[model samples]
Target: MRKKLLHIICLASMILLFSCSGDVTDELPALTRAQLSINLLNNGDVDQQEEINSIRFIVFGSTPGGVRLDVNEHILLSTPETATDIDAQLLKVTSSNDILVVVIANEPQSLTSKLDGIASHWTLQDMLYDISDILNSDGQIISTTGMPMIGVVRGISIAPDETQKVEMVIERAVARVDVFLEAIDGGAVTGYTAGSTSVTLHNLSHDSYFVMGNVGNGTRDNADSSKNYGKVKENVPEIDLLTDTWTAATSDTWAYSSATGAKNRRLLCSFYTAERIFKSDYSDRLAVSMAYVPKGPSDVTGITEKVIETITKVDDKGSPTAQPFTEIRRNNVYQITARVGKIGIQILTVTVEDWGDRQDIDLDMDL
Candidate 1:
């Protein structure tokens, strides 16, 4: 599934110097004042309430020779709006020097304040691109403020009398995982029904950078095994029970037939995590541990115990293998599909998707 992203368009209008009678005059210096209008367009379906909570614009000015100047400042444009698309206007006097605009959205108040306190350009860049503490007090992936996003439009030549339209694209700072489970009757395992299932994700990173770069301050890398990940978590648990009504149904699984004659699988769990890489030996790679209990009356006797399985990767024939799932990246979605039967659980497919692109990793395992 694709995540909804926000598209931002900036319109900058700079006015020319005018005489007392409102006529053009060469006697006065050119006016450097500008009025900027930013229209934030929701790119996909209806907006989620917490998708955008606040927006901050930072404008940095430097000399033509790329010499860093002290003319750098940031402004909070406005609180988030409920409309499908939002427009914010900013009027300010800026120099004619080349400017770089950095727009950030949905950052928490504490992080925003900390960003505002930094005075040095290089220091601010370091803090903005890489930081920790992404989790909340409840240990959730992101705070109530929402998913943080950042966009940069640099090397903008701010002329005295010109109108410019700049379009910026913002991206999510975290990755999402969606897990699906289905029970089918086609394989060697039969007469067993779907049951109460629990999906546990392993080796998740807690800290993530605001922007993408090679020098990661949090996640572990495949090349280096000893470096510490920013508080790497193992066996993060998520459990969902099968209701009595669904378990007693005629179908063997929690899937329902669609109008197109396709079975819609049940979503076991979903979550967000920071980026991370597996070790060279694939010892610390990401994985999922699943537990399934047979629900209702089962055809097979003496099956009261639940089955537990850990899946990292599998071969073409649905058996565990040593192939590594190398890395998890930001602004991406990973979907894992598995089938449960009398024998045990079999991972069917794993797919990684970005906003527009998708790739499939076909690895199967029987537990």
Candidate 2:
């Protein structure tokens, strides 16, 4: 009888223990779901809007254990549909700590597969891209594929069953350069027109990372051929204007003729380049090559000249200065204003400003 009573007590103890275990399990938090509404702030410009062909949205969460991902989605815009805003459902959100949200726009199709490897383990800086894939053979961002852009939101608290509306500003990963030729006092040289001028960007890297940083030199594909400028005109002497004899700048392109006598500072050409930041040294920095005709007196035969001048910095008056210009940030516009002065003297102004804001950095080339 005593053994029977002891067995009954043992069974009772087992029942109570399981009941306590169930209570403890119930006290722990359960994974929940939330919703996210992403509103991409954009200008209504059609050209800018066309750059956004698709978008990839990702959410990452961290805990004492390890990293976790609640969402990974890529959406392609339909015909004539510019995705200015988006809505996504968040799954398996822990809500214990803040989460990180990343959005990338107009990435290559191959990136879709690469992103899968990063879903479980990733960092913001680990997201790198080869610049060649983003640029065309002419070293310009491909309009059909669209320009690359990114936006990140961190420390976002997503409560369970609550919809969070977030506003993000996405910026391009490339820089745009607009060239303007303005005819200043033609100096002693007569018939010197701003026409027959060509600009070339030199010392550019063939490959760079799309990710923004203080320095862009990282692992490159090494096969890229965009190291120099694009569509350079033939018969343009590569010799230095300061040291070599003068040659006339000539091009069959109609734009060359239209640039002449641009006293009103008409747009010459627009091109794009990868981002760059040079803190102290400017050797690896991008440089501009301006080739134009330096007109002499009409009566003087064989006095007309063409020369290529390379400039690295600009002064307050927009002339190339000895001081080094440091950086070329992404999504910024470098407006070059070339002012023709006396023969062999040209002043150039390089105005650096955000794409959204217009500023002047005039480059006056007085030749």
Candidate 3:
């Protein structure tokens, strides 16, 4: 599943500079300066379309080598955040005959280090890392957000003074998990007695790394395999479902992979049980057991306490047969569902849905 992503350029006009030959007459029409009308199609979480803080695009000389984002400010860049489309005008020059266009949207200023690291060879992994603990100065986890669509158009050349329309298709670099609580016959987790219980998906990956352009989805030089690129951070907080039928998912659970991987990643989750102590080694694939708090009916006086909680994992399509290991991919949504009751907890998997595309992941999940 280490797939190479191709950069799609909607439109682009390459410009070339040359020395003057003989004295030319005014018969030829005057050429306008190089300009670009950048059209940004909304990408990323459907709800995050309006969250764009700023947009930036860089122009570089087209070569076998790549360009850098933090290198020079004069390569012709723009930060037009308000428009679905932006017009950028560049100063005339003559060193290189071709250029590349890279547009990064909604990037956090905290990652400004990437500005200097942004180059043709750098992948999204090179420019970023995951923040599992969104903590305050006092060390309390905060609700932090992450996601940025990257678009790149390379090898673009324009006839002298001709304007080009480069359509850039930026794609999400990570996967999204949406937890849903499907209680049967008004169970304990049926939004009725949700206050007394807490549930969590274990082994959540906290870090990710990948290359860009036609390069592989993993490390640039297999740099992170042993360090193992991404892993679930220890002591990660549980996902509280609250009063709603679903867990409080203000944003994606984690931003890790953009497509299926050669590795088999599973979401080890527990039933809606009472709050339990959280501990685990980030490096282990299947670490400690999930948390579960068993409790009888709050109002029923004659009812006896419950025990023997059973947990079953189902296929991606919620089939009766559960997968030995649930496979995951990027730019997709995995809805891990739970049906709670006095008997036990059955975890069901809804079909995997790609963020911006309609084709669902085939249940085979074999890369």
* Most lDDT-accurate candidate: 1
lDDT score of residue 9 within candidate 2: 5
Writing each residue's lDDT as its tens digit, candidate 2 over 47-138 gives 44433577776677766676678677877776323544433323323463656656667876546677755655234344555556766655
Ranking by lDDT: 1, 2, 3
Question: Considering TM-score, where higher is better, how would the candidates rank from best to worst?
Answer: 1, 2, 3
Best by TM-score: 1
Candidate 3: list runs displaced more than 4 Å. 1-33, 43-48, 63-99, 117-125, 132-146, 155-163, 185-189, 192-195, 210-328, 341-343, 359-367
For candidate 3, the per-residue lDDT at 225 reads: 42
Worst 10 residues of 1 by lDDT: 240-249
Total clashing pairs for each candidate: 2, 27, 16
Q: Against the hidden true structure, what lDDT does model 1 obtain?
A: 0.49
lDDT tens digits by residue: candidate 3, 1-367 = 1111222222333343333334644222333234355454444333344333445555556334444332223221233242234444343432334455555544444554565455653343355444232223322222132244445555455565344454545644445444444333322323222343333344445343321331222211245343222222234344421111122222111211334551112232222111111233322222121123232343211111211122234444655543333233444455444444445444433455554444322222100
Q: Which RMSD values do the candidates have, in order?
A: 9.1, 18.2, 12.4
Q: In angstroms, how far off is 285's CA in candidate 1?
A: 2.2
Of the two candidates 1 and 2, the one with more favorable TM-score, higher being better, is 1
- State, as a TM-score between 0 and 1, how close model 3 is to the true structure: 0.50
